[model samples]
Target chain A: MSGLRRGSVCLGLCLVAALTANAQTDAPSRRSGYHDMGKPLQAMQDDDMANPGMLWVGEGANLWNQRFAAADKSCADCHGAVQSMSGVAARYPAFTAGSDQPVTLEQRINLCRTQNQRADRLADGSRELMALTAVVAHQSRNQPIAPPDDPRLRPFIAAGEALYRLRQGQLNLSCAQCHDDNAGRKLAGVTIPQAHPTGYPIYRLEWQSLGSLKRRLRNCLVGMRAEPYAPDAPEYVQLELFLMDRARGLKLETPGVRP
Target chain B: MGNAVHAEDGLRPYRIVGDAIPAPLTGEAGDPERGRAIVANRRVGMCLRCHSGPFPQERFQGTLAPPLTGAGSRWTEKQLRLRIVDAAQLNRDTIMPPYYRTDGLERVAKGFAGKPILSAEQIEDVVAFLATLKDQ
Candidate 1:
């Protein structure tokens, strides 16, 4: 009877181990290939380094609440509440019919200003745009990055996949060579995090400020000895669409803090 | 700050180059100037960022990756060439980016349409420069 009971206990332990591994690998709404989620790198650090994205979000909240326009309308006037904007950032990099390009959250936010608020489109990389984007991204913290699966974006995703696989520059390195093959390996002193789309618009400690996804992409290209795409380029847009799809079900922690 | 640390103590031969697969090079002779260009070219080699070399134009280089002065003494021309081309093929878990393989890349820059990042000639040139790096 005791031997039978021991066998049963071993089986139970094995089942528990399997379940834990499954939870890690097959967890729905979890970012694919990311090490840690929800917690900012700042929080992970023993020392207190204020998150730059949070700083920008504070500026955005002020801008949202402050009065604007001749009608004295502000972003918060209609949205009034901040939490309603939650989950909004995750659905971005959307398709545009006229341009036939995947529009990023920054472009969409600017479009709202131009169309609804009767305001000029914010210049790309402006402080105001950063603040606005930070606030929107902050709202979507922990929400899965559910890039809308519209048929229009299929071509871009395909293009991005091709780009990810193709070699570039004199060194002849591809994006997949490092991010996919050597991911999670130690390079020099830093651990190579899998190039997942979970923590984007991140505040990199190296940069000492918040940076957009495009910036990171450009950095990768440079690292590969490949010429970087122009800012807001079509190739990058296609790549972003593909990344969003690949990172499907991962939480959007935009304006995220990262080492 | 000093190149001595990178040259003397920074990396072990096994660690810096990683487990690189040995492959036959496709070019005949190497060109150091072309190699220099490849190293400097942001769209090509971009070696100046990581390893300090004969490039006088570059000032700030990475301490994490070792200097490439005595590379030729440490590794043969063919071995250095293969490592430059694809370090990951030898070691499945190497952080060094593979430079020559044409398969499985994403979001290639528009200028590199339908072509490998570098031609066989360029790889030879970079290898030539690496061959010049010997401990004197």
Candidate 2:
């Protein structure tokens, strides 16, 4: 069994090597991740019940009501009915009440757990963290993304735009070269999107798992053969803010499906 | 030959004399067969990411730039070498990444900050493969 597993791993690497040799990764195909997917993936996203990401949504719902032993609290106690939280996620990567640092929903959840419930911070990329973020973001489903307006966020936004345009990696490609400059063309069968941040806790076919927006950003950095920043890195939050700003007024597609 | 130079031979920045770069890219002759593989491979040249070509076997050609077909007829081997080295000289805003040049780029991975994306031999090989793409 171990030998078979090793063989499969080697095959995967060889396939990757073969595919990369034939790559045209520099196109500017700026459609949304949604528009890039095929029919089967689209259908999976349309029906919440059939959407595998909803499984995370389900887990989130359960986490929302469970009491935390640390502070004897649950999200339900303070936030009230989940439905009432609608439109909340739409405005995030926003300036929190106490801190000036803008935060994504994942960061907010960690803050709530540590500050309000006195619970330990959820591990980055942990299943529970994804679940809670999905639950919170799902409340804002179908709402237009409304990233908060505040001058305090200006510096971060500028930094993000700089990062977006700056080329990186051995390929010497930048996000702008593809996402901004060539948003609608194909890159060896994959469509590159304008790279909006409306979808968080997305169900990506490539991952075969639901993940946060930050996770995807890290993937892009890795794809460039560059070292990826950590999940909690300020760059991720700032990039999240900038993307949300660019996608301003576009409807939120939380628990979104992507290929 | 051209494709014979391995990346491990280590890359040195080429002088982009523009309309004057010496051809056969590296000092050696390039193997057209190997050169062709480098252009198609995602791990190396990734030329298809922006340009289309007569690579029928390789599906998903990009439409961002001009097709690679007829390239041999349009540009001399020397010209192709310079452009591939760094097209920024011809068109400052060209989305094409510098396949061989390594200086003056921003936010490069620490280890690759000074290294060209393609080794000198790889560039010669790709140029050789491209030179074969005559308008038929």
Candidate 3:
């Protein structure tokens, strides 16, 4: 286990170095959203009591163990304690069998509820989905994010990367302009941290709600003066895969707080 | 502010009003005061989100693009009007959102369909405010 971790760590460091290597020599080491936040927001994320996202995390804990009569099952029934699910969410957006489609952690959770538990699929941003996904994600709170490198993901990864760099919308901005080239810089007094998908199902004060990564992407599209995609669009999945791949070594901060 | 402009009530197409560089977007004169409010507002104009300028009192001013501090001195009112209406017409690589243009945009949220982010009057208003910032 330690050896595998070391290898992934090496890959993670290589990725980081490559990013900087591509930039001017004067640039400082990249920083996370956590590093760019003010003291108050940081403290808020640290204290579970003050963290509004914890409310959703708690809800997820209940849903895990709660039995659904319709499905004649509960997540805990098949998976046992939620604790065992640790480090599981960190390895998601996995290239699955059959079509080899990459499934996000949220999609995987929904798959289990519908297929194994015979329960209705949860809607995106539904409190139940947020709670369950958040709960499952919380288990891997500090685990390093590492999507598998199956050869199958290569095409999708390339497609996702293309989308990241592709300019779209009336504003003609791509994800790279703000996150890759100008990350850690101030934009409207807000630090545009590298577009890392570390903390998700995150609590955003702006939304005054916990939302998925897809929600943030939609918001970015809107900010770009482009129309936002519908919930869980294939384009979003492609983008999510790229974001997670870019964020390979960052520790999961699910239920993270953002201003 | 003449005749109350009364522009934001609905959607309409915009045409350049004069032959000059600093032409009015429409026959109506823009109220610089109203324009200032819209530019500072995050939801409405949100200029400061990606622009830094002479507004020292504002907080969280981003430094993503060229500041608007000397915009009036650099570009004529007509030029500013056109840029605000659709910056893509100027620089295809520009990240500035077109405040008034409504064509060729993909996947706009249902609420904003067929509607520009800022109304035509609001675009003029932003141009008005931007025109007040002389280089000095």
Candidate 4:
């Protein structure tokens, strides 16, 4: 009886050691892509006047106040001053009560447009959609990414984590392999980033335009030679959720500039 | 049956036997000097994007996969041919891209839809170059 008890104790100790090792390896120290940029690009992101993404942010401010004919009301009517939305973008990809899955900030905006404003939904990557998302996300600038704490989002987070780790496409590379394991390494003279989604509606020098997080995700999928999910695919939002959670303490840098 | 042509993409077909493509894709032998140039050029072979080898002139090289220093010593010419053609046939989870395969791929860019990343001649060139790298 004593031997059996001692054996169980050893097993318990072994489990704890395994779990600790897993946590250490899986959860590397969090660092934002911001730290990896050159001086000029970082300066561009910092200065409002110099930043090209601020162009969209300005347009977003206009759209926020403009009254739609169908709804006979502006976003400002219900939500009030745009500044009131401060820190809203940080806690995104959150669960809604009736919905089985979490909704991305983009999806939530579309839902509000269709349901409350009676306005036509904006297509993904459209100028108007990017403008509006930039304005909203810009409000949460410098705030730490804070994923919502709800049990309903647990399964979705797990699914997102699995997708991030799953090897796909002809190249057979996982997001984790590049963004997590080999982030600091160089690929074709460009440094691979940890790929935190703190900056959506970011302006990429390669694109020469402001783009959403989904658009960036699509770019990576294509780079890996994989079939990317659709614009409104749940996979993107789930992955976004996992990323926000992964970058829990990092400050948001919306309207960010990237080379 | 041995030298059948793939109809859709017009790729020169070669048979796979026991983890190696026993024959070359192109009928003629490849030029090793030209092959070395293709591997080093960033926009061409993209080999250095995921591998580091004897190229001292190149500043940045990837760390995602095994180094190519002893590749020739480690693999035969036939084995290297198959790997450059398509590593997926050997290991399903390999991160190496198939340089000479076009089918069974998902959502390839419109411009690159039916064309392989490297032509048959380019594949042979790369194979020739890789085979020359014996361990020091």
Candidate 5:
């Protein structure tokens, strides 16, 4: 009985070794940490119910409450109240009935600037612009990030995912590496947040101001050693669309503060 | 061939000049005096922060970068100029703040737009000063 048991144990070890070798040889794509642990946005939005990042929302609110330029048109003046602004954010990355292209909330705000407020355009990712963006995004707290139901959004989403996977820059690291493969690991000094879109309008202590998802994406590109895309560039829009898809179902936390 | 006398009788004292060497640059525009003024001025090129130079009695220098005292001897004039023009252009991994107008700088005074912090003449002057550091 002892001899039979020993033989069975040896057979089990041999089987495990063969399976490991087979798995290694058959593996098709070796994706990095960023894209591997898929749908972190959904998890952060759905499962991580804690609102630890709410303080940035308050700061964004304060920025919104403040007057802008010489126009004295605070976001509060037009929107009237923030509670009324809720649920408007999740509908973004939406197809514009006019342009027939997808536009993020930041672009929409710039549109409001050009058409409604008659104000000078805010430089993309500028502090004043991001502050207002954060304030607006903050209004959408607790709402689900629903996929853009329009068929027009399909091409844009595909474009975005393609951009996400494309390699760029001297380091040759992709967004998928850190955010997907090593999402929670320590690189350099800081903890790599799951690259979920949950924290937007986040007050990064380094930035000393609130910023939008696009601004964060630009920063990520810089971190990846790639030259930054212009704020209104189509590549950024495509990447944003892909990021939103990855973050599908995650709750929007505009104006979130992060280390 | 012990300094072989040529077959021609009374061969004129053969001037045996060795391998041709490039002559050092020289001109009135190459002024180390101006370079001295720049090195001492706090409002201008503040290279002293990251580097130590021949500047006397300056105790407030930060040591983030190496000393530049013997830089002329260590690097060629062209190499030193590139270092001053844009450290990033030379090495992507360098942490040294780029003094040259490579990119991304904005909000400059109107007259200084598209110009490096230090002018090319100023760079030439600095290079002249650095070139004096060669050992005897």
Candidate 6:
């Protein structure tokens, strides 16, 4: 009986040790928004031919090869093939030299356009831009999100964390309150997701079109009855950086479908 | 002011005392039946979006805030009125939206700029209904 008691106590001690180790090493377990989706939506995401966002991807392929009017240069002139950009989207919102702040993948695309192709910057929600972003991000599908480790990005990441936690709007709820604390719980028949930015230029069934992360962020702000930041606001980029870092190791799913 | 009209936004104004609004925006008491309808509705009160309560027929109630089962026993009608009017007065970080006040808000949508979420009568009615929830 004493031996059995000792064995039970040993098992309890092992359990406690395992739990402590998990708490010390691992952050809270993360579930992507995809998992929270219904099976039909998952099936839609799985089949590229069935996915509506692929229409934009096809348009992007055409745009990638077409010559720009200003410089007589196409995106293919500099970057050989779209496939070469694999894992590029995963390490985005990176701090590039000469620019003091970090730039999103969309910004990088615009920068390349203005500098290399001598083309005008595309508008925030333009179809051409969305198409191009969709195609480029599609190359990184299934790659784990890998936020860069530049020291310069530390302060911006910290700021993003602060904004995520800060309560605002007439509702006075923070992003962390819904996404972090109460994730997996129901709110008006919809499951509150962890707000990870693994997908971009995604096709939302509600929108019936592909949209960037900024558009979704704006929707959340409006839902909270808060004033959304401007299109070119640094706050949006900062938030994107924070979300990417938060979603490290999660697989990318550009042109993703969400209900 | 006890029952002043807010000249800026044209909303009926009431004074705040301590943690509660002592006076109702509408002079007369509100209908509890109408109040219950608003509370259960998805568009009007949106109460069930963040709060679960004694609502059995309603599916998918929220888990963000406290349940509304025993609101009457927990707080007085005056306190409930203040909460419905503007909960931020009591707790700065309360997720509850201010259903009455219209001023000091930022970047309201163009159509809803000056309009409060609920009318003065609606606020009173909701308060009345909440006061009847004595049983847990």
- Among the candidates, what TM-score does chain A have in each? 0.83, 0.86, 0.87, 0.87, 0.69, 0.89
DockQ for candidate 5, C-alpha atoms: 0.04
DockQ of each: 0.13, 0.35, 0.41, 0.50, 0.04, 0.50
Global lDDT scores for all candidate models: 0.68, 0.80, 0.80, 0.84, 0.60, 0.85
Where's the lowest-lDDT run of ten residues in candidate 2 chain A? Answer: A24-33
TM-score of 6: 0.82
The segments of candidate 2 whose C-alpha lies over 4 angstroms from its true place after superposition are A1-31, B1-15
lDDT by residue for model 6 over B1-136, one digit each (tens)? 2443333357776777776777778888888899998999877888999888777999979877788889989999888988888787777666677788777666565556667788889888888998999974
Model 6 score (lDDT): 0.85
Pitting candidate 2 against candidate 3, the one with the higher TM-score is 2
Compare candidates 4 and 5 on lDDT and give the better one: 4
Top lDDT model? 6
Model 5 C-alpha lDDT per residue in residues A15-114, reported as the tens digit of each score: 9999999999997432222232335433433332433334444555676666656576766788777666777776677766466678887788777666
What are the per-residue Cα lDDT tens digits for candidate 1 across A193-228?
557776667777777777777888887786554678
Off by over 4 Å in 1: A1-11, A17-50, A96-100, B1-136
Q: What would the DockQ be for model 1? A: 0.13
lDDT of 2 at A189: 64
Residues A116-201, model 6: lDDT tens digits: 89999988889999999899999999999999889989888888898888765555567898998889887986888899887798
Q: Compared with the true structure, what per-residue lDDT tens digits does model 3 show for residues B33-126?
A: 9999998887788788888877778977988878989999998887787677767666676677767766666655566666777876787788
Docking class of 2: acceptable
Query: How many steric overlaps are in each model, in order?
Result: 17, 27, 8, 0, 15, 0
Tens-place lDDT per residue, model 3, A1-259, is 8999999999999999988877757654654588788999999998999999999989889988898878778888878999998997787788655435888888888888777788898988789998988988999998888888788777787889998997766555788988987887788899898978878889999999999988998889877767776676778888888888888878998888988
Where in model 4 is the C-alpha error above 4 Å? A1-28, A97-100, B1-28, B40-44, B52-79, B82-94, B98-121, B132-136
If both were scored by lDDT, which would come out higher, candidate 2 or candidate 5? 2
Whole-model lDDT for model 5 versus the true structure?
0.60
